[model samples]
Target chain A: MHRFANPARFLRIAKPLTPALFWLGLLLTLIACIWGLFFTPTERLMGDTVKILFVHVPSAWLGMGGWTGIAIASIVQLVWRHPLAGVAARAIAVPGATFAAICLITGSIWGRPTWGTWWVWDGRLTSMLVLFFLYLGYIALSNASSEKGDTSRVAAVFGVIGAVNIPIINRSVVWWESQHQKASITLGGSSIDTAYLVPLFIAVVGFSLLFGALVLMRMRTALAEMRIEARMRRMAQG
Target chain B: MPHAPFIIASFAVTGVFMTWLIVSSYLSMRRAEASADALREQS
Candidate 1:
């Protein structure tokens, strides 16, 4: 695992994997979209509006997942000082921020019809909004720092501190009397019926793959930029 | 459901946002790769 810590080796491995991931993500997203839009039955209560869950839920999952990735990478970069961890942290931020934003927007869209408002000051919603801002802060801090090492350290601290909100975000439904719904998939209970579950699961997998592909692609871009910067700096110094 | 307009609005808004995200990311990555190629050419 650590052997691939070298960016060069990681790129060599990821280059071929990129095409495969791209196709897989594309195919799955297409299938999920078709299944979700047409195949899934409309909820008798929410009716066609319920279809928003297909996109909204998966994006919410990925939003949390991306932050988890950043937190782990940040920890690794700070504690272990893994060669590529900082780059991984930075690469993950772009997609994480995008996913977080999507989750918020989609949730707001879903809320307007169901909750009677497009925006809410609910605990869960507010925490998720904070998560999105945290991602932006990490990106901005990383970009603003002059030294690579300093940037990584600053961003790492933010990543770890921001992570305290994830559990708070997750548990906001239970902690506060809120309009947001509880877990659809619980340890011993699933709120969703079997009919809705299938397509929902498909969408979740599809969205996960899409997130993975985007993160990997962005990482590759960041790696390329770093290489170019390093070469230019070396030339100037020489 | 009872609200067709709201449903359409939701889908349209979400779809447009997702489309923009995918396109912008692709363009950004493309530009970065182009710059990398240009810098490599210089070196």
Candidate 2:
């Protein structure tokens, strides 16, 4: 971890890996989406609306997973003072927020026909909304700190603290009886049918890879910006 | 198949947003790399 803390070393590996991950992720996601949309059997209850699960579930998972990345990166930045940790955290914010927003929108779209309403104040829904807002706040705070030329420690602290909502979002459906369905896929065993599970898993893996690729790309950009800033400072002093 | 519209909408939204993000990130990286190169040439 510490060895890769050097930006140049990180770039050496990331340069080749980024396009590979991006293309692979794109291929897999396309296959999964096609399979989920046309090949998979519709649910008896929800009919074709169940197809929404492929996108919704993955978005929700990545939405939470994004913040987890931020929290872990925050820990690395705060404790180990890893330079790339802050970069990793900042890189994740926009995509994470986008995933969170997608989750909310798709979930709402799915809910409209099933629940007879476009919105719900259910536990899962509400907590996930909060998680989205947390991502927005982190993005704003991180940007502000960077603009002001302050250490990202404040944003890192916020990243770590904001993680408290993750668990709440995960357990919300279980803890409270809500309009949202309880966890269909869990450690105990998945209640979902095998047909649905296969495409869903593929979608999740593809999206996760895409998420990783996006973060790496953003981190590379951030690193480049950092180098430019340092050069400008040196030129100014000289 | 009655809920086809909803399914299509969900996928459309995800597709559009994900594409935008990927393209935007790639372009930003390209711009940053170009600027960095210019700076290196100047120095």
Top candidate on TM-score is 2
lDDT of 1 at A37: 76
Q: Estimate each model's TM-score.
A: 0.91, 0.97
Candidate 1: C-alpha RMSD after superposition:
2.0
Over the stretch A1-238, how does candidate 1's per-residue lDDT look in tens digits?
5787889898888777766776787677677767777887878878788877877888888888988999999898888888788887887887778778878887887788788898989888999999999988989998896677777798899999999999999999999988898777877978898777887887788777767767777777878888878888998999
Worst 10 residues of 1 chain A by lDDT: A17-26
Per-model fnat list: 0.39, 0.83
Encode model 2's per-residue lDDT on A54-128: one tens digit a residue.
999999999999999999999999899898998999999999999999999999999998989999898999999
**Which lDDT tens digits does candidate 2 get at residues B1-43?**
2687898899999999999999999999999989998999989
After superposition, candidate 2 runs with Cα above 4 Å error: A147-151
Query: For model 1, what is the alpha-carbon lDDT of residue A160?
Result: 90
Which DockQ value does candidate 2 get? 0.77
Residue A30 in candidate 1, Cα distance off native in Å = 2.0
